[model samples]
Target: MSDAAVPDLTELLADSPTNWGKWGPDDEVGSLNYLTAEQVLAGAAQIKKGKVFTLQRLIGDPKGDPVWPGRNPAVREMTLDESHWDEGNNGPAFPGGMHCADDTLTASLQGSTQYDALGHVWYDGKIWNGFDARTTIGGLSKASVAPIAERGDAGRAVLLDIARHRGKEYLEPYETFTHEDLVACAEAQGTPIRPRDILVVRTNHLQLFFEKGDKFYSDFCEAGLVYSPELVSWFQEMEIPNLVTDTIANEVTMDPHNGAALVLHSALMRNLGVAFTEICDLEKLATDCADDGTYSFFYVAAPLKISEATGSPVNPVAIK
Candidate 1:
């Protein structure tokens, strides 16, 4: 084909009918087969050429005085009931002690290093692909989220350092990042976005949260650091399949009127049939990879097999 007639990656994805018609009620969205184990291994090999950055926080007891005035589940103590164990002559006589862990867990929701499934968000009481938000988040299983599952291995991954692009490591309170800001960052980095590509936005929020403590969380919520609806529409039009960022929620900020925060979660996860990753520490990854280039990697994640849970804690890795 002539250069003018040749379709780019974004155009090809946008033009695919399978991509557009894959959403259905009876399907599994998050499954291991999304990207085969072999594919994941290959991506890891490529990433090994450089250092592999870990994005997960240590899942242990919370530390330090709660300085951030936000809901933090990680700060809650994990408790175990020894009564469940069988009493032995000297101690509990059982191969393994039976105990229940504390449930009051809170930590970073969107930005601490996690993946947002298609069922993660809801708009007007409806989830992405028209799944009932109340029913799906409360009862759906991985097998039930199949429409999302078939389109697995969301092709390619792109990282954008908005904070660095603007000449700072952190954004001030209420500093809204518009779609133009993202495009400009891509332009500055000389990397154009492609469809089915997983886009990671680095706000350095996690670094600020770790360094400044709880004040950063309070200020972040008060300041409204999120993407606009127009920006969400841009991703949908571009046919990008995934979005990730270091924030509490996918939306730029919480809406007080409807008690909805992170509207982008609704727009993308619920409306655009796109998956999202939250609480990701992309600063290191972006720095290691350098923002001027795109990386073809295999993304892997295993969510807890909890039926009907709103969301489960997951550990996701990007192998390039």
Candidate 2:
């Protein structure tokens, strides 16, 4: 398809408001319900075409401190004599009966709570343009919301590593990123910001969470780093579809005592048709794009089919 044939960002957002809605932290389960067999084929074709880079975070336990908020529960325990299977009730009953197996598996990618699709959240109890949330995906189903499928594919994606562009692997506590920062990063990379792009930002906070141990979550909550309201307004004006990042909450951590939540979430998912992606791995892609001066790519994501659940585990990929 020619570039001209590609839908404009505003048109894409207007036609599929829920497309931007799938990447949020609080989007309703099953709000993204447009997964068609053709999308799966398109993704498979990209993989076959090569030059595609995988961006999903590895879903295994790391030996060091917790990479996220939860503990690693995959360690194996020593087996006692009684725990071993006896070959003989009185004598040897089976050959290989004395063998032992680990039988333990670690969980990666929290599926029980997936990223909310842009159509997932609603302001004034409604989604974009007064679509009722309860009657939509937020109300009846868990697999996907209306217009969005169980999985989503076929959109333009762009990466803006704000922290990296600032020459740091991470941002400081409570630092609010601005629209200028985003534009500056794109400029530095020589990639102009375009509308209808699925934008991914790298804070490198995931690495800090792994390094800080127990202090990570508390410190993050206290730091209050996030996007400003103006930035949200900018996205709506630009008509961007989806936004993905490495942070779990998709906004600056709130004040623990005050409970001030992510205003960006309210502005994007609630007001505009933009959604978010949390816990993404953009380090390698960002580094490469920054060096090569190419940041646009074909993006795709697939969510598991867990009925009535808040969210399912997803593995989203990007092809440059």
Best by lDDT: 2
lDDT of 1 by residue, 1-320 (tens): 24555433233323222222354455445222233454445445445354345555555424332222444545554454454343652433445744454446555433235555567655455554454555663455432333333344433456677877889877655566766777788787776665445667777655555666656665356323354446656766676656666655544564432334465554555555556656655666777656425434445555444444444455556655
Report the poorest 10 consecutive residues by lDDT, candidate 1: 11-20
- TM-score: which candidate is best? 1
- Candidate 1 local accuracy as lDDT? 0.52
Candidate 2 lDDT, 48-115, residue by residue in tens = 23566666665544634233355342343543443455544243234765644444433442422135
lDDT for 25 (candidate 2)? 39
Local lDDT at 96 for model 2: 65
Error of 1 at 81 (Å): 14
